[model samples]
Target: DRSARLPPYGKKRLKTCSFTFRNALLNIKEELQKAISTMTARATHSADVAANTSKNVAEKLDLALAIDKRISKLASQAIDYSSQLSGFDSGLATQMASFQEQMSQIKRELKEGLGRLEHVTANAESAGWYFNDCTC
Candidate 1:
């Protein structure tokens, strides 16, 4: 009777060990699937970042070209403005010179007229007598 009881206990121990093995295998399979999915997500994210970086670089290059063109255009405009300003300065200088010449002529005429009037006044004061600088 004791020998029959030992066989049943041995069968029970065998069944328990098989169940534990199956559960462990299932856990391992689930963990491996999760790791594969994480890796795939990371790869896709990296690809998207690289593509965006290329697009940003292209946009920057185009903007730089546009800025260069604007700078060149502004430089041309500045040169034209300087040339016009020089012409205006030259014209102003010429006009100033002409005005100075006219003013000098007016001063000379005034001095001659003043001298003539003073001589006439002196002659009338002497009753039709004329006198001038003379040497004996």
Candidate 2:
């Protein structure tokens, strides 16, 4: 009855309007789908990038920890070597002092022996024990 009330030109115009509206709704739906797909792709790419960055950071952290451990070990070894060197220096100093004392004692003994030899030589010359006159 409503269609019968409309003029013949009005019915044709209504049909055209309906078709245009349907086409517009379809276009809107396609644009929404494209936007969702683009957003999903971007999200996936961002996730991959974030994962790689996290892995790199973890590897770098591990390397830093290993280096720290090595440095600590080296420091400990250096301390041990320093202690050994200190002990060696102390021992060397003590040995040098002992050697000096022994040298001093030897020097004193040599001087006393030289003096006794000089006295014996003078007594022998006064007693006429000349080397040339002795016929052995």
Write the residue-wise lDDT of candidate 1 on 1-136 in tens digits: 5445768877687668778888888889888888988998998899999999999999999999999999999999999999999999999999999999999999999998889888878777675443333232
Candidate 2's TM-score reads 0.75
lDDT of 1: 0.86
The RMSD of every model to the true structure, in order and in angstroms, is 7.5, 3.5
* Model 2 weakest 10-residue run by lDDT: 127-136
lDDT of 2: 0.94
Candidate 1 lands at a TM-score of 0.58
